[model samples]
Target: MKNIKVKTLGAVLAVLAIANSHANETAEEQGEGMLFRSLFGDTLERTYGITVSGLLDIGFSRNNRSTSDERDDGLSNLPITGLSDEGLELGSLHLFVDKPLKANAIPRVTPLPGPKPETADFGFTIEALYGRNAQFSRTYGWDMGWDMNEEDNAKAKRDRLSFMSVPNLAATAYLPYGPGFTIMAGVFGPIIGYEIPPNIRLAPNPFASRTYAFVSNLTTVSGVLVGTRIMDGPHGLLGIELGIAQGWSNMRDNNDDKALLGALRWRTPDMNTWIDYEFMVGNQENESTRDIQAPTSRLISADGQLRQQHSLNGWHRFSEHWLLGMELVYGHQDGDGKPTTVDIVTGPGFDGAHWWGANAVVTYQIRPDLSFSVRGEHFSDPDGFTLFPTTTARGDFNAITAGFRYDLNHNVSIRPELRYDWFDAIEHDRPFGNGRDRTQLTATVQALVYF
Candidate 1:
């Protein structure tokens, strides 16, 4: 408790300091300083060239089916984190500061964010969140005081629906060689999918409700990553990114195992179409898993087996009013299957686990401030590894969602969505409605107030 208090206090003080970082400068000298004064009053971006933004998301959701039992509430949206519940709750209070490193050597068709380009050689980004969405993104070794432990559970915080989490914090350095190299070190965003992490980005959420595929994808990592633009001519823009990290979501390396991560990207010169292939290969097992693994457990010894994930995602701007995007993900983990959220690790069963999923989305812009989107996805967790790690829950979940985004203004937007889910159970009789029903229907509406 003391540690959490200290961390909270420190964060508050840091934000206060950064808020007043350039207060000494006059509003006249900074054009944006005057513009934003009516809003946030000279934020870091206006004076010191640091981008600061925040979001408050509040919403309500209704699930047509749910369990009456308290052990697990089907309305809580098990196996789903972002919209993981069926009631009106404070989704998240998000804040972030970003100083982007400019790709000085060449200009690209795609747009980057910032008031103006800073030709400086170094930059950094730090993002944090407090609310119901923190449970899944919190890293094992990294979330220290912010994580849900015995004490938190005692308070009946079992939904894992409320807390504080830091998803990404890293410093970037630009090199002058070739098209220019961008080197970054620290915790980095999820690289295995097209959807931006809820905690990593402040605005322009792809959709109010997360897809089945994305929820089962990967999360953050503590590591060092490098990237460079290899092509900037008329043919198009091409780039490559590579990195090394403490396996999966591990914030601090718990063993000798490490993961290799990278991506290959290409985009049309017109910026109308793009695609990327991403991959992460390494061992994943925290101390808890190691302590309770069976004699045959791969991670029990130094020779931990590799956990591999691959993602292929792309999108095309079909026209001024139309766009389409898609993603496919496949991964597997090798283990003795004795792990279940550390400390309480128990039985041993399967030798390996595999999961795969695919999704596609289409969006139409009826106007600038209002748009409509529809998505359909199918995800399978036959081995029960990714979706239900603590129990023998194995199945395939298929869902379709349709939603609309209406921006009342530049700072606030409302999103209403309808989603339908059906399950093909492999281990249990059903996946929803207390494991008695195979289908679940839900409706949700959320509003994002940005500052």
Candidate 2:
């Protein structure tokens, strides 16, 4: 408790100091400073050329099929972190700051230059977050002040008051070699996925809630990433990134092995259409299973085993008011049967499991302040590798969602959504309600305020 208080105080002090760093600069001289002030607080000004923004999200949801507890919400087949089936929930509160890059900050070299281009500038971003969504975004090794000797359950430990979390704390530096080649280090999310992370650039959220594949396969990566543009043109653009990280959903290195991360991002000529290809190879372990492994259990290899994942996401705008988004993801984990004891380290008997899924969303803008969207998805977890296991076998889940966004004003918006999920019964009986139901329905409404 003392440490938490100290940390909180330190954070508050840091915010104040950073917020006041540019006290001497006027809005005109600050450039991007004025833009941020207009959106954030009236006093919110750029400090050292860094801009600041924030968001607050609150939501209410109910699951019609949940019978476990009337008061407690249930989200069958959905990511456990976003669960809010039967009550109001504080989704997240986020504050982010980033230094704007300047065109002439770093020198750029061209093979045959008609005119030498200006240098690239250095930039960095830091995001401080709180609430249930923040907790769900926690990376491994981030201590929640839990007593390991008394309890090892991740969920149970999180039930305490450790709600604050830092999901993005990265710094970026551009190189002088070529056109703005840059390296980013620290805790940052992957450059994949169609769903926008909460509290990012001011944009309309495509949906009021999240999807299973979004939470299960797409998580944050910790380490360093190097990125540079392959082609930059008014008609089209291409970029590539490569990096090495601790591992999936991990904040600290758990072993000697490091994960490989790579991505390719492309945008069409108009910049309204874009696509991304992302891949990762590494090792991951379910801390719960490994903690209780008996010494006599067959010696498992260091870092456990191999886990690989791939994803492709794209989006396009058909007109001023209509747009579409799509995503495809596949993930696999290797767990040889010989090491029976270590097989369930990540999940129930998922020694060798694979999962694949696809989802599509369509959005229609009725007016400048009103919009609607619909999403449908299907995922297959053969051997229950990527999803919460029920009955230790392969299972399939299908889900559909519909939602609409109504902007109350420039700084506030309201969203309401309905979702349905169902699972296969042949592979395993009821997967929800303590294995009592095969389908679930849910409804949710949320509000977002930007600053």
Best-performing candidate as measured by lDDT: 1
Candidate 1 lDDT, 228-289, residue by residue in tens: 77776677777778888887667656667788988888788786888878888887654454
Query: Model 2: how large is the Cα RMSD against the reference?
Result: 6.9
Q: Which stretches of candidate 1 lie over 4 Å from their true place?
A: 1-40, 67-75, 104-120, 146-161, 199-205, 287-302, 336-346, 389-392
Model 1, residue 446: what's the lDDT? 85
In terms of TM-score, the best-performing candidate is: 1
Worst 10 residues of 2 by lDDT: 104-113
Tens digits of per-residue lDDT, candidate 2, 332-385, equal: 877655444255334233447688889898999899889899999887776554
> Where is model 2 more than 4 Å wrong at Cα?
1-47, 68-70, 73-85, 103-117, 143-162, 199-205, 286-304, 345-351, 389-393
The Cα local distance difference test for each model comes to 0.65, 0.61
Question: For every candidate structure, what is the RMSD over all alpha carbons to the true structure, in angstroms?
Answer: 6.5, 6.9
Which ten residues in a row are the worst by lDDT in model 1?
A: 105-114
Q: Cα lDDT of model 2 overall?
A: 0.61
TM-score of each: 0.81, 0.79
